[model samples]
Target: MEYFSILCILSLSVVTFSETCPKLNVTEPLLFGDKNSNTSYDEDEIISFSCVEERRLVGEQYAVCINGEFYVSQVPDCQEKCVHAECAKRIDGYCNEGGECVCRPGYALFNGSCIDKKSVKTVISLATKWIPDYDHNSSNDFKVLQADICASFDDVFEIFNYTLRCYVSFKKSNQVTIANVINDFTAESIEGPSDVEKAINGAIQLGHTVPGMRYNVTEDTKANSTYLKECDENSDICDDHYGTCNDIGKGNYKCSCIHGTYQSENIKVDGTDCSVAPIKVGLTVGLGIVCGIAVACFIPAYLWFIISPAFGKAEYNTAAAAEVGSTEDEDEDDEEERDHKDDLKRDLEEDEELDKQLIFHQTMIQNMSNFNPMPRVNRDSQSYGVPNSIELSTANSMDNFNHQQSN
Candidate 1:
């Protein structure tokens, strides 16, 4: 009985230890291993998850079965690996590994939308029909028409509250077509249809025609309808030096003249005939004014250069003559002053001589007054006769003295 009881306990323990985890319910993630084939995973069993092409797996890449449950830290998710946000909204488009938007087979990107090649060809044909002058052989014209129609359609559709869609061929095929068209156009130099050229000329001549049918068509179309001519290396229509032949459109050409050259007025000669451009009246007047001003300034400068030295010399001579005159006048004044001083000295000398003579005369008179008639009385009796001689001699001396004094 104890053995049976031990066996039952052992069986219960075995049943309890044998646990399993349920199948994962995550979307977009692919599970790998035998556990995926089964409804439940055994204890300690490992499972891995992965994502499809162009998608990245987010969260845990592996899960472990433990204690009747999967020990997954996080649920796995597959996200689209796209670089451009526009790819999300584009129809039939996906981002490649290089992070560029790619369209499906037979589809191309146009106006931010993926369109089929068939639709693109249809749009091209429609545009050609609408534009009667459209050159089917020219890829450039085709491309221009395509763009115009697409833009017009987009505008019309938007006015009605509708989304605009455009068509474009596969990039490689479109590029090849363009290359072939260019080669063909270069190889052939034949003119376009005469009927079409006539129509173009007629439209140009009328002057009053539909507006905005083609870009710059009215302005580009001349009376001669040169657009119908083909220009190439062999073409001699344009002047070799003054003009250059350029392709305008519709297998036609025109001459572009160099600066200072323009098309000749002769109607018989086309744009190829160039002549020297006439000078403008404004330019001529401006040149004349400039020249006149220059001459006016130059004459004054020349005269100043020629006459200035003469004026300077004349001024120097005048200053020198004035200096000489002043010096002569100063010399004359000095000589006069010396002469006046000599005359004054002579007058003073004369006065001094006269004073000395007067002093001598006064001394003589004083001496005569001091002399006494001393012996006059004593001699009067004794020598009356002799006295008379003495008296006569004294009188004579006195008379001589008086005459000398008066003189």
Candidate 2:
């Protein structure tokens, strides 16, 4: 009896284990079959898998229980689905399960398409000296005020949907109110501040007003609200080399180009990019002008001071040479004149010496003529009357002296 009882107990345990299967573990957004409330399934049972709204099911849709285990060939998945085919064709975006179109960062949905937020024209207005009739401190009252402001814009612009992206209040002298008005359908049609002002006045005419406030479209405040979305989404949008991003207002930014840089031509679409002017071209033009001026000045200066003076000096030297003769010939003539003067001086001295000698000779001849000469006596005087040798000698001497004096 004890052995039979143990055998029965073991058989009951085996049957219980074989009849049950573990529960499936699925993490995706899904809808289950009729037996979804049960934690586990019986043997040979089947469960169906389906995706929730805006999600499409992938892989196997059903799992079957074989023995004590669930058998599935491929795991099921629920992926996001786009219900509207236009969402895929419009831009690089997707439609969420809630049927809302989602665009990439820095982009916003406008006119059923995604576009850069900067390109969307927006208008901002300030209500000065505002005093609301209701309590402004209550959150509910504030929300109602925002809704009323948005409604006013919708009525004025004749747009069914107007989005208010910004609202701010200052706590000075009866509160100041500033609001951003945007209409996706008519954003591109807004011309300028005139259009904005007209719309604001129209809204005021339609009984959208504070107790003692006046609406004025502030053109300078356009940057404060229009670009806030893009700036907040990406603070580092400006390129580092070209410029810096500046937060002009709360959640608003503007890119300021650095010195020596300028806003690029695509500033409408790419506000953060800047470019430098062509420095090479400017430098070349400047150098060319300077060189041209230098050459112009140098040409006149060379002709006036250098070439003119050189020609004048050459002409003067040539005339002087013609008047005075060549330097070497003049020197030779001066030396020859000096030699002629020396020869004349020598001749005068020789003539003076000759005159002195002639005077001495004449004196000697006169003395000789004044002297009486006795005739020579000869021992043989009684001889013949013919002239003796001594007389002839004296006579020859006298004749020679007289001839010399006369000559």
Candidate 3:
């Protein structure tokens, strides 16, 4: 019997190595991804997988199964429950009796059983009144906030709905009055979430107002959240507020800042948030000083149009004196020119008389020297014969003197 058992073992071993290797079977793969990744199965999602513990690894440490053996390529697999899905590196939660994987941090045990914060939510409600006018003729049921958060709505609303009203207001972040339409106007605005909240806000802002209304929020009950709806991923308000936003109906969320505040912290920081930064108003006197200085700077403009032109009057007076001196000089030059013309006329008349006297002296010398009449002779024709030397000398002297005078 011992020999038969050894022979059977030998046969099984031979068959296992006979031109073949042992076949490998995978018990479904478990995947691991980065904690901060929002990729479920998007193009950017990088996931890696491996077989669970106590299972023979058919591939490498970050390996993924493509066809037969798991390959080592990065893949997407939040559906495969891996140890990386555990909350805060917690080593718990696995595939339970059902086929779906489990996650950590008290997550619901279905599908991939881990809570992704991106998939999480925080629900709030119309604390005092989210609307501008929430109390007109409106009669929608507004449940009261319970004293204890752990109590049921069915149990607490029966006792507290009557005492749950708050003064509605739209106050700015700087605590200034943006809008105040109280009275019956309040009752006209509170409707279901499906109505026009954005349109109402738009109209209010067109008149230079904000939609930040004040309200006294109370828990309907502690056992359950006030709103069971979810917010849309397209909504940045919920993310920007860190999920401390409004879950309108199913998947739409509105970023709800506290009554007297705006978003500075995330959603995790809630009620019991005490203290505030003191409000500041700029100094009006300092502004007045600046404006006063501005007006003072412009004072020189008055001088530019009025007083500065008076300084140029001295230069104008000097120019007027120079113009008067020039006129007097011009008049004196005209008088000198007229006096010289009169002297020239007198000289011309004297020269004309001297020429007539020289001609008479020449005639007398000619007659005495040639054909002598006793004292004077009328000689119209050329009747002068040869003149004596003495007579010719006298006539020549007269002619030379007359030429010198004419010149």
Q: Which residues of candidate 1, in runs, are more than 4 Å off?
A: 1-232, 247-254, 265-271, 320-407
Q: Write the per-residue lDDT of candidate 1 for residues 256-344, one digit (tens) a residue.
A: 56665666643222344555566566855765565556555555655655565577557556656666758776576567556755765
The TM-score-based order of candidates, best leading, equals: 2, 1, 3
Per-model TM-score, in order, reads: 0.22, 0.27, 0.18
| Better-scoring candidate (TM-score), 1 or 2 | 2
How much is the lDDT of residue 144 in candidate 3? Answer: 11
**Weakest 10 consecutive residues of candidate 3 by summed lDDT:** 386-395
Error of 2 at 42 (Å): 52
RMSD of each: 60.7, 57.9, 54.6
**Which of the predicted structures, 1 or 3, would earn the higher lDDT when compared with the native?**
1
Candidate 1: residue 173 Cα off by (Å) = 36
Colliding pairs, model 2: none
Q: How close is candidate 1 to the true structure, as a TM-score?
A: 0.22
